[model samples]
Target: MPLQAHVVAPSRTAHVLEIIKGAILSGDLAAGSPLVETDLALQLGVSKTPVREALKTLEGTGLVVIRPYLGATVREMSYEDAAAVYDMRLLLEPEAVRRTVAAGGRLSAAERALERAREADGGVARSAANREFHRALYEGCGNPLLVASLDGLRDQTSLVSVAAWARRASWETEAAEHEEILGAAREGRADEAADLVRRHVAAFLDRLPKQDIDPAPPSP
Candidate 1:
């Protein structure tokens, strides 16, 4: 008996990428779990070519690792890795906030994202909304390169955020931080916005598990 072929969308590669990335971010695909192209293709109702391409693209974003012989697996973010990612964000995000404020970028998008975050239940929904709030703020920085860089960094750090959320029921606190940051940006207080974002990211770093410090290479 022949298995029926699934219809491929015009943006098949991108579709596959989002599906796989969402699975990883939501922890449906755990860290270090093998990403078999055949299985993913079957599960996503797409062909293996798009799945293969999506894996390659995800690898570039540091979300998935592809070894020569071992194949693809979700990347495990170590404590050291998380610290470094947060450190880089501290350096970049504040500047992004400042730039957005200086340019007087429309802040309504950020406000909406904040509302979504506030309304969402804790866990993946809230975390996703939190990410959108940050993106809405920084994407207005008027620097495509910086925005692209931060987007990649955000995807890579989602695992850390999910793990942190599980350990500390701090969604309310995080929602409050986003509100304050949005208020500062809306008021055109570039310095205040910058400072708030800096503090917000730093607070998240403080919540990460200490035991995750050890770096573990993906099994090959």
Candidate 2:
């Protein structure tokens, strides 16, 4: 009998997606920077097929822009986009958290995320932890579709967050706000928790830069 294969690598597209997305989020790739498929494929030791697929996925996530003749580049952040993204979050996230709290969902993951955010040394890690904290608060709302909608906005929201951090160093304020939100949730004050989340999101929106933040110049 032939030996069975138990170990297999994840799909190339998924791997490439993580690499490209990581770079984008960490500012390694920068906003508006070109995502040249050939260069990426060569750098990543893969073919253009995976790079192309990954770019398409990033585009869907609002992290990449593909123009008719420009190919793919990292998406830029602007006040308008920030308003739209956070406006939707302000509408959906608080209510979802309210539902989750009313249902008495587990919050261990949320607490862990909060801790991670507090300990993070930089904007990227903190943003990721912040995302996880919010997700944990709302992911147990018993509505998959609602969760999906929130999930759809995550990448764009995170991108805007990093940009906001770059403009203003106010993570301390946000971290304190998160603590209050988590405290309310932990105390089973559903309505209060919801209100805190709304305030948190709205405050972040208010801090967004009004001008567009373009990506770094494209490689020569």
Candidate 3:
């Protein structure tokens, strides 16, 4: 079955870009998978122009790569690329969490976060929900730039995490780690919470395949 792009407006190419980007981040579209315009246009019921525009937008963001004759594919993550994104997250998100926790008030969202982490489906959905939960924890940090940058980093890290999730045998443990971080945050232990997140992120990055591991390159 072909996937349809849900277009809400004709002028908002960014909206379409977001949907496709979400698809990529959530692991609905795997790395190295080709994006066919005609099929996407037909599926989305939108004109080819918007589809093209959305692809261009993603290409610019480095989420999708466009080639001359081969066309567009989701950008693949090498061990180095994956490690860099996660390492950045390890450096940045803890600060955001600490700042938010220090400025503490209500953490009603944390309850929902725990639930989502526990119940969301394995693999991509779990990772997506986990990312959202982390964002919710830091939404009160009061820095718009931090929030936006962390959001992008989270999306990039997710791409690598999803790929790892699909290939690894112990993928089920990610959800449990999410809950541990959320629990620390919910308790107002900003330092401990940040430490937990740092460790959680670092552990995954440590396991990433080296450049020489050679993923059985996806079929053409």
Candidate 4:
């Protein structure tokens, strides 16, 4: 009998990206932690090439930084960076919500995401669901550029360990606020939806604890 050759699946760059992203979002990889390709490749059960590519993709999303000589490391979300992200959200989200309501957009996806958030226990799952809820709300805004910008801000904020914050903070208020915003949008109350979104974001920023950036140690 002839020996059978095993078939290998093609490179899974997306899979690698997701694993690394999950690690970062789950707080397994802290901010400023060095991303050594060899270590990551071994940990992920893939080659260094895939890990390198994934890191580059993560860099584009502002989750990883590739310095000229220092290689890749998780990006730190300083207080200033977080404040700027919140400010941008405050400026853009209101209009996005208003536009979505004016267009009579369906809230099915947003509703599902909100439900997921409500059901999820605190941590990465809840944080992810919360992000999905916001994404779904603004996705029908009829402006791809605006949506993309908001997505980038959301990703950057995630890198700041929003899940960790969720674990520590009381999320009941956030859920209630989301329900009110969703109701306003579903009822086609454009101005009210917009105002509610603005207030929701502002309140979140107000509740965030002030903290200095503590950079992670480099990987050995």
Candidate 5:
């Protein structure tokens, strides 16, 4: 059965994108699931124009894959792809967080995001909160270019994290790690916070299934 996403008009494409992005993160639209325009349009009570535009945007986010003639499907990350994403994060995020911590950056937002993630029962909610928490950690690094680079990776990171959650149901462990990272940052232990961030990233990567995902379906 096709997934149904409800949306209202007026900048409907952005609304549609968020709705479908939430579905994908929450596993309502599982990896490799097809996104048929007609079905989505009918289900959403809109014309195919908005759906098409939203899909094209999602494709750029690395959450949706589009083939020449195969239409669109939720993206599937190979083991190498996952590793590379994590590796880039390992090289970038920890250092950024360290700079933020060293600069005595504000961290009230990170604390709030941590609480939200702990309270969230859905993967989508947790994913959004998690993104916010990490953003708070690094956005204060005083380097806009570095922050921008990290922002570029945020969507891919969310997809990878959701996949990791599917393999291991205990996000509490990750939450605990976040607590440690934040604690160090708040205490002005910049190096410790940076190292903790590194460990946290590596730990999540280790938790991923030790194999590449199946190839994406040509037509879902």
Candidate 6:
């Protein structure tokens, strides 16, 4: 039987979407896992209607794919997919840091945001916070379009990484990279900051596991 939803609300669809997203990010819903509306509705304690809506939302987000008569399946991460996302980040995010540093002082805000992100270093929530911190930094770049693009790219990237990210030693390494970028931004050196960000993204792309997604059955 599906677990009951903790609360009933007008925004039930959005709530359901968020819960499934959390499940995926926390590795409870691994890639390629079947997502039956009935099963999900039961598990989440919501009616099938909201679950359907939520699945539709996720499909649009590239987090899941809904095939006709096939139901919904969690999207797998391929190296090609990861590379495409990294390419966008390479093209836009570095420039965002450069523009932000060129526009004004954002070092203080970056520091504060980084601190907030680190507050949950070992849990699912921490991954969400960390994504926010980086997005906040890029949002300061003063280009709304670039910020939005990078935001989407980051979300796609997270879908591939958030599951095992909390267990990697590189989490601390990434924090240090953030510090370096912050320092460069603080010194009013946009070029230096861009350089650091560029290399940081490159290094991350190089280290991702090649497995993409496992084909094993979902946990019982």
- How do all models score by TM-score? 0.89, 0.91, 0.82, 0.89, 0.89, 0.86
Write one digit per residue (lDDT tens) for candidate 6, span 1-220: 2334654778888889888877777677877889999888877777899989988878877888899988899888777787788888898988898888888745665677788767874556656666766675678888788887887776577765574464344567777888898888888888998899999888887766665333335589
Q: How accurate is candidate 6 locally (lDDT)?
A: 0.75
In candidate 1, what are the lDDT values of residues 113-209, reduced to their tens digit?
7888778765777778788889889998999999988998877667778866766676778778888998899889999999999999999778656
Error of 5 at 83 (Å): 0.7
The true-structure Cα RMSD of candidate 1 reads: 4.0
| Candidate 2, lDDT over the whole model | 0.87
Question: Which regions in candidate 2 have their CA more than 4 angstroms from the true location?
Answer: 1-9, 212-220
Quantify how close model 5 is to the true structure by its C-alpha RMSD in Å.
3.0
lDDT of 3 by residue, 130-185 (tens): 77777887777889999888877766666776677666734456567777877787
Which pairs, if any, clash in model 2?
31-215, 32-215
For model 2, where is the 10-residue window of minimal lDDT? Answer: 1-10
Clashing pairs in 6: 2-42, 2-43, 3-43, 3-45, 4-45, 5-45
Q: Write the per-residue lDDT of candidate 2 for residues 1-220, one digit (tens) a residue.
A: 1111122146778888888888899878877788888888877777888889989999999999999887999888777777889999998999999999999999999999999998999999999999999999999999999999999999998898888778677789999999999999999999999999999999876765575344435599
Q: Ten-residue segment with the worst summed lDDT in candidate 4? A: 1-10
How far is each candidate from the true structure, as Cα RMSD in Å? 4.0, 6.0, 3.2, 5.8, 3.0, 3.2
Give candidate 4's TM-score. 0.89
Runs of candidate 6 with Cα error greater than 4 angstroms are 1-4, 105-109, 121-123, 163-168, 212-220
Give me the overall lDDT of model 3: 0.75
Residue 61 lDDT in candidate 4: 88
Higher-lDDT candidate among 2 and 4? 2
Among residues 3 or more apart in sequence or in different chains, the pairs in candidate 4 whose N, CA or C atoms overlap within 3 Å are none
lDDT against the true structure, each candidate: 0.82, 0.87, 0.75, 0.80, 0.87, 0.75
Give the per-residue lDDT digits (tens) of candidate 5, residues 50-132. 98999998898788999989899988777788888889999999999999999999999999999999999887789889999
**Candidate 3 at 99: error in angstroms?**
0.5
Error of 2 at 188 (Å): 0.8
In model 6, state the lDDT of residue 9: 79
